[model samples]
Target: MNEAKIFSYGSIPRKGDRAKAYLYFKEWVGRFFEFDGARKEDDVVRVVLLASLNNGYVEGSAKLLDLCGQTVRNHLRYQDPSSFLQVNHELVDRMKRLGALSKPLTLAIDWHDEMYYGDPEAEGVAGTRRRRGSHYAYRFATASVLLDGERLTLAATPIVNEPVIDHVKKLLTQVSELGVKVKLLLFDRGYYSVDLIRYLNSLEAAVCNTAAVSHKGVEGRRG
Candidate 1:
C-alpha cells in the first residue's frame, strides 16, 4: 500500500487519518464541481487536487500521477471560468469555520503585470508601461490578506480594460459577501489614481498607502 502523507508536524496521528484527510478534500471539491460520468469524473478530481497540492501546472502534476495531461484540458474545454468562483468562497468558509478569520484582516491589493510578447491586438492583452522589453502585457489584480507572516489570497482577477475602481469594488464586494471584516487596506503606488484614493477615503477602515499621496491622517507605510 502507498504510504499516506499528511503535512502535520511531529504531532501524533490516528489510524486512517491520512486517508480521511484525502477523502475530505475530495468530497469537499465534489460538492462544488460536476463532470460527466464518462469523463472519469473521479480521476478528473484527483488530477485537479494533485495539481493544486503541488502548486504546479497540469502537465507536471499529470506526470507524477501517471495521468495524461490531456484529461485535464479536455474537461476544461467547455468550462465556464466564472463558475469556479464558488470554490474560493467555500475555501474561505472552511477557514472561517476554523477561526482563521475571527478578526478583522489587513488586506494588500496590488497589480501584477505579466509581459506579453504576442500581438497586442490579441484578446485579453492590455497596454502597460514599458517593462521586460514589452509594452503590451496581461495585467492581474490580486487581493490577499496578511495572515501570520504570509499573504493568503482573497481574490484575483484579470485586468482586461476594466476601470480600477470597478475592479476594486468587485473584489471588496466578494470579500464582504463572505463575511470578512477589514482592519486596514494597503495599496501599492500603482493604484495611485485620484478616483481610487477618493473611493478608499469613503471606506470606514484605516488606509495605508505605499505612495506619497493619501487621505488626511492616513500614514504612508513604506515597505
Candidate 2:
C-alpha cells in the first residue's frame, strides 16, 4: 500500500480533543481511499482533506499541508480517472457499511447546476437558462436516499444532453448495483412526467412527485 505519511503535529497538542477529532476524520477517510502506483496516498488524502476543510481549492489545501501550490495541483492533475472512480465506489460502499442503505430505499432525485465562469473550451460545460449567475454551467443528476432526518447521496452522474428520464434510469441502475431495494422515489416538479412514473412503476417502486399544476385547487396528489 502506497500510503502517504501522516502529517506531523509538531508542537500542536496531540492529546487535545480537536487533534483527536482530526485524526479520527483522517483515519475514516483513509479507510475508504486507496491510491495505486507510486503516488503517496497519504499526501493525496491530506490535500483533499485540507481543501475540504478550507476553501475547497488547491492553494488553500497547500497552505494547510505546508506544500507548494503547484505540488498540490500536480497531485490532483496526475490522478488516474480509473483510480478516482474506484475511490468513489469504495466510498459508496463505506456509506453502505455505515447503514445508509440498510432499509428499503426512498430516493430523492434532483439536478444540481454549478455555475461555471472558466474558459469556454472546458469539457462538460453547458448552457443553463435556469439561473443568472452564469449562462454556462455544469450539471449533475444526483440520487440520494432519504434517511432519518438526513439524505445520503447514493449516486451522481454528469449530465450532458442526456434525456432526463434516461439519466434517472441510469441513476436507478447504479443504485440497484449497490444492492439497494428501491421502495419509493421522490422528485421535484421538474421531473413530473408520465413516462418517468411508468418507469418507476416498472421497477415496483412507488413514485411521489410534485405535479406541475396549471390551475388552482389541486394539492396532495399522488401517483
Candidate 3:
C-alpha cells in the first residue's frame, strides 16, 4: 500500500497528499478530455471545478486562476454536458482495475438541482419544486456509493422533464457497465414513483426507502 509522503520544509514547492491528488486528478482529466477550441483545457477545467465547488460563476473562478474568463466561458459553453457519462465510465473502470473499489456498494440515487437565473424557456431547464425565488432550474440525477465515512458519486445524468426512473436507469446501466456490484440502493423521496419503486424492487439489490446516511430499512416504498 502506498502511504502519503511527509511534508518537508526542505522543498521549495510544498505539495502534500491533497495537492498531489488534485494535480494527478487534473492531469488524468486533461488527458481524457479534449475540449473544443480550448488549447488550455487544464485551466478551463480547473476554473469550472473551482466555480462548481464554491457555487461561484466560472468567469469569477477563471479570474481567480489568472486566466481569461471570457475565453474559459466560451470553451465551457460549447462543451457537451452529457459527455460526463464517458468520463465516469473511465474513472470507474480505472478504479476497479486498480482494486480500489470496496465490493458490494450501498448506493444512493438522488436528484440535484442547479438553480438557473436565466430564462425559463431555455433548453434543458426544468421546473424547480419548493422554491419561490427560482421556479426554473436544471435538474440532474446522481448515483453515489455510500461507504463508511465517504460518499463517492458513480454517475450523473441531466433530467429535463423526464421520468426519474429513466434517468435512474441510465445511472444504473452506467454503474453496471463498469462492473461494480451494488448490494443496496437508497433512494430519495423525489424519486419515489410507482415505476421506479417497482424497478428497484426487481433489482438484485435491496431497496431502501431512505437516504444513504439514514435508513428506514427495506420494508416497502415510501411516497
Q: What TM-score does candidate 3 get on C-alpha atoms?
A: 0.74
Can you write out model 2's per-residue Cα lDDT over 48-113, one digit (the tens) per residue? Answer: 776755436766676777767775566566656566556557666765776767767667777777
Cα lDDT over the full model 3:
0.67
Q: For residues 1-223, could you state the per-residue lDDT of candidate 1 as single tens digits?
A: 1113223322535676545555656766664555655556777777777776655566677778788888877876656666678878877887797799988877777777767888999877988778879988777777788777656788887888777888788877777788887766767765666788677667654333321232233232111
Lowest lDDT sum, 10 consecutive residues, model 2, at 210-219
Write one digit per residue (lDDT tens) for candidate 3, span 1-223. Answer: 1222212323435445445545555655654455764578878878766775556887678888899998887776767655655767776776676666747777787777778878889998987654648877887777888655667788878888676678888988877777787766777655555676577666653433321232434332222
Pairs that collide, model 2 = 4-42
Ranking of predictions according to TM-score: 3, 1, 2
Instruction: Identify the runs in model 1 with alpha carbons over 4 angstroms from their true place.
Output: 1-24, 114-123, 127-138, 203-223
Candidate 3, residue 10: lDDT: 32
